[model samples]
Target chain A: MGRRVKVLLIGFGSVGRALAKVIALKRKIINSRYGILIDVVGVADSKGMALKAEGFDEYELLKLCEVPRSGVNLFKPYAHQGVDLNILYSNTQPDVHVELTPSEYTSGEPGLSNIMYAIDRGAHVVTANKAPLVLKYKEIVSRALSRGVRIKFRATVLGGTPFISTLTSMRSHDVERIEGILNATSNFILTEMHEKLVEFTDALKMAQALGIAEADPTLDIDGVDAAAKIVIISNILERPLKIEEINRESISRVSLRDIIDAVRQGYVIKSIASFDVRGGKASIRIAKIPRSELFAQINGVMNGVRIRSDATEVVFIGRGGGGIETAHSVLDDIVSLSFEDS
Target chain B: MLGRRLCVVKIGGSLLRDSKSYIESAQKIREVFVENGYKAIIVVSAAKGVTDKLVQVAKGSQEALRHIVEKYLEVAKELNSVKVIKRVNEELKRLEIVAGAINRSGVDLSLYDFLLSFGERISKILLVGALEATGVNALELHADELIVTNETFSDASIDYISTSANLEKLYSSIVDSPTIPVIEGFIGSTIDGRITTLGRGGSDYTATAIASLLNIDRVYLVTDVDGIMTADPDIVENAKLVRTMSYRESLEASLHGAKRINPKAFEPLEKFYSSKLIIGSWSKFGTEIVKEIPRELWGPKVIMNRASQDMSYMAIVGEGTSSVQFIRNVLEIIDRNGIEILGLQSYVHRPSLLVYVSSTYELKTLHLLHKELFEGV
Candidate 1:
């Protein structure tokens, strides 16, 4: 009934496939509810790129889910394999560019370059990748603002469980401080240590087996992931914090003995990530929280963020680090961007 | 790949103990199906001890995680493909991320199912690699993407209509593809995409569901055992394999503590489409369960000892088990043997008769019934 929102998906990994599935399955519902139909015009993965001017059909989208290589194979007779991203973008004019490339925190190469390219090309950007925002949040935000395009990164934190959107919506209430379990992997490991009486390394190993920890878990265990989240939340709160400025304490030092001792003292050791608006500082550390506290009860792969504001103290808790869950948030941003244009 | 006969083969967790078995299984698939011009959809479970270890990992045993990674890595090494090994490593890395999250976060049943799924997911990848190494074109198909279930978490039931629709759509897409789709069993997903597992021993259910959904003729449930035995092999030295059984009889055996086939696996065959279920090991063609039994085969098929101390004999008779003549014959046998029946129950619809007796006369009763029903005939 309304204008179709043309979209270009930059990554065809699990999260990308998940987003495509959601769009295909929920197309009718989305169109009826939001008055906009999503037309996925282009999709690019490591293998190559697939572009269709008339938008991919449901069958093609389903094929993309099973494609072993790049989604370019989904286009079959009409696909342009191994096409460069810049050329692909210029050829297929999509209004919204959905970036889901893997995060590279240190340099933010691919995600940073991809976002900048999309913004420069006058296309609105919606990203689930956190690296670009963590490395260059202010620069990217300012660049997008200057270009008169919008950038939504709700999926960057809490796997798209309304952490950023909720905080931004409460901007009218003058928030004083924010603290909770921002990183699900670290929180899960800490909970495992306390409940199962295993050492930190053991807990981390279990997390890895369960697909909750990355192979290189330094970011999660060393508090870098939480610090990045704090930086993003701080930026959104108008405090603008850098990754280097945030003080972090890794969870690797936590032991079963420490957990037992804390429990004996009627407390739980939680990997708490916090931001103090007054001090303009963010910190991630293992804090002994009371057993009855909200953060103490938040356990495995689930993230909880407590916001203390002048109006109310609110706690947002949800299952984190799922491809589909994160994709839902990315889709929500894409829909929001489309609505803004209309 | 066009117009090839399709068959769904399920490999039980027990069969994947060592690298040799992985190769053996690929060879078996090639010999029995692929060479015969049939396309195989392989459904696999986690390695024998992997699921248990993963459950431990979920509960916070970091040691279990190392074993899981090492086991898969070892299998990948045996496969010896750089692409396959890299894929396995990537999956292991992803698994670490999930496990770490579960360890840090408190356990939710839904999340636990998601955690448990890595076992089968990783196994599927390894098996696909092994199959490809054996020169069979194979692809890993995550069941969570195809099988739709309710939000019941650990023990979820499949939504037949939606699942059937998804399977049909998936089949149509891959029907012409040359690659054999290797799928993970025991795990599916809610419509909203949260992971949910069909309960333990659910690989058979997955295989059967796929077979019936695709309207395939037969499904092979490859396990360690030869097939459903006449009696517990450990208890009875002369226990013999039963070649054929009916769905109702299998269900009866399952309910009375026989762990051959999952009871849920029969739902698709009984409700939607019919398929022959062949269960056995590589060396033996053990049991074949069909939709209907012929008239001659309609009698007590399996004599099971229901309990150890206060022994009870559950006679799983075939169709017409509730007939007046059949009940009379059973009573006559017990009376003639001078066996004391403490309690007795029989269902008109189901072909099962439970006879309770004292521990002393349990063996005697089983012997007499077996002699009268099976041997005498």
Candidate 2:
């Protein structure tokens, strides 16, 4: 038998649900190719916790995805209400803990507590949640380092493509600056506002309808989501900055007249996240991009990040966000962590 | 935002014959709607004969994909929008891939439906380009993602509840937005995500459904003809336009095989919002269809000469054709003229009355009915 990796899923929202579907679909290929079989042994939602030490099969996992929001307790046979995390952890004994809770910036909520618990149990952690990392990057990473248990969160920054490994592995550490369209919601809104001459509110409504923006899009519109990504990047590059350090202009200030005026000047207003590492400053600005540039080409719900290093500059673009896209990134982190010298 | 008025418009295939035609239609939209300070949601059909071309490709026709790509790109190039050109090229490439994949896997009805969707998909993108070119800001909405339908691939039935919810989510805010969204007509996706078509002449259905579901009041269906005519202009020497009719009358006329309107287009209009439909060319929007008109305004709006399998029919379609007085008038005229009637069909519930006659008198019957009921000549 190949390496059997047991996973525990916490928080079953859009991303969590997408990750489950993706894992079920790609399990066969992953098992056959990498000689590793994934078994999701436990799932936790707001209402309750569901545990099956033997792991959920494909059909059950799919059925689990169909459950109504915060209705994990409704899942039969293995579901229970108000189950303690300690007992839940001991029951499943998961090899890898996957936390996909919503990112509540202030307290970092359930994701922060869940990640801490997983680290204490010496279980590897793979996260799609950015709040905890953006809020407590050094504390979390150093804790995982001391525990000798790996923590991978590539999904937080890269939607469905590789970026963190590439950024972290690059030599010659003399990095100058970084600019990216990191947040999908803001990018989609800006693209609509500038290209289609839509107002900021209407563009945001479009984003919400498209499922690119959550019901409460405060973090995205306020530029915290992009700043969070920058903070993660800064921490990775060993030049950490507080989340508050990034001065950001809310995209809600954008108007149809502003976009129309920008078009007249052969420019498009884009929400750009810039980190001047040399100057030790990070800011999210409503920057005007020339029509002929690569930045202007990144429209809709696509993310593009450009790394300006000492000798060269590199750009990485991928889908900004979707449960399935981020799930693929999450799966990669799991597979790579399984292959580590444990 | 509520200060801006909204209407839905469908640019028909007959009008979109060439690149210049697309630009002209865009200019008409700008002059009529945008300049008049009304925001519009435009539903566009494929260029004339493109669906027929797609139908041939669906039946294993070879090398036709390139021609389709060129046809769409022709308009894109004229509009001079790089963004539109790029989108059209990408969609065309996807079409080619879908076509190639179907060829490799062998063709099926579902895949055939998918192949057919490209015509409208490409048309919608080009229309957006054309609209933007005319200084009217517009965007393209993908119908396959938004319009929900049943799994019947070739002749799909729309799930109005799901489709309405989706449309309301994406398009409900259009009045607040500056740009008009141009969407593809005659195409939708199944609840399980298979592409589908809403049968032939279904573009009108797409337009009316969007209007009714979004609670928008007016729908303009721009065709080559001026409006709903009394008789086929080719068949009768002096046929006049039917200026106004009810939704029920329009649906009845269409069911009797009227040429201009689609029967399915009235379902949501009558069932949901009862939006008014304007069926005509851009310059003269002649035929106005409301959910209901005053009873006095209910009479024959169209007379058609139809035949199926050697049986000839002169269909006199109107709002009050089933009324006792109107039926008496029609019978008296037929009797006085000595017209040989094979059969007759009329129900109190229906708005149309059908009279079966010999093929020899089909055109004569159509003309006689048109003169008496419409022209009063």
- Best of the candidates, TM-score: 1
TM-score of 1: 0.71
lDDT of each: 0.82, 0.83
DockQ of the two-chain complex in candidate 2:
0.02
Please list all clashing residue pairs in model 2, or write none if there are none. Answer: none
lDDT of 1 by residue, B1-377 (tens): 22538788999988999777788888888888788888888999998899999899889888999999999889888988665677678778777777767766566576689888988988887887788778887766779878999888888888888888887656665566677889999999988667899998888889999888878888989888999887777866566788899998898888777887788999999987799998898788789999988888887778876784655665545676677788888889889878888888787888888788887888777766765666653
Q: Which ten residues in a row have the lowest lDDT in candidate 1 chain A?
A: A66-75
Best-fitting candidate, measured by DockQ?
Answer: 1
For each candidate, give the TM-score of chain B: 0.92, 0.94
Error of model 2, residue B229, in angstroms: 0.6
Look at candidate 2 and tell me the lDDT of residue A94. Answer: 87
The candidate 2 chain B region of ten consecutive residues with least summed lDDT is B168-177
